[model samples]
Target: MAQIDWETLAGRVENAPSLLRLWDALEDYAQACRDVGCTEAECGLDLRRLPTYGGEWTGEYLFPIRDDGITIRSHDETHMLLDRERAEPRYVVVPRSAYNL
Candidate 1:
């Protein structure tokens, strides 16, 4: 399958009428996660299929994870634009380390 266009996907989120408010909320959540050594964070709105319909919104924040001089590469799945069922108005911030997993 073709990879989802994250830049374009982000654009969708950036275009929301309440972008600033939403962004601030996400940033606060992400900062809290980062303070606790979190690696990634994301928020997703009502999603059920590809080419999201109305009332759909999504956002993501990724932080570099370093371990032993190695930086783990990761993508934010919450901002993905694929056909899938995602509950509306969901906010999740993964505040943990993968290196210990």
Candidate 2:
């Protein structure tokens, strides 16, 4: 019934032991958050159950939909914790408009 703690969730994913598993966790958690946000359910828990078993993990953040042929520069020098499923420079996009010129 309680809302998810996404910040805490992301931190866990960012520090996951395996980037592949991290990608999975981030993807799942983010998607769950998106679904709950769209539905606006009064009882958040009623939505898809948390993907992780222990309370340390928040299974609700999905991978970001990035633009194709675009380069992302982290002004803050942030690093990417990518996996085999990492987004590519020329990856797929949806809604058409999601792709920028």
Clashing pairs in 1: none
* TM-score of predicted structure 1: 0.26
Residue 32 lDDT in candidate 1: 46
RMSD of 2: 13.2
Candidate 2, position 67, lDDT: 43
TM-score, candidate 2, is 0.34
Range of the 10 consecutive residues with the lowest summed lDDT in candidate 2: 71-80
Residue-by-residue lDDT tens digits, candidate 1, 1-101: 45434444444444434433334443444344445564323333222111222332234212223332222111132322211113222332231233331
Off by over 4 Å in 1: 1-17, 42-101
Clash number for each model: 0, 8
Off by over 4 Å in 2: 38-101
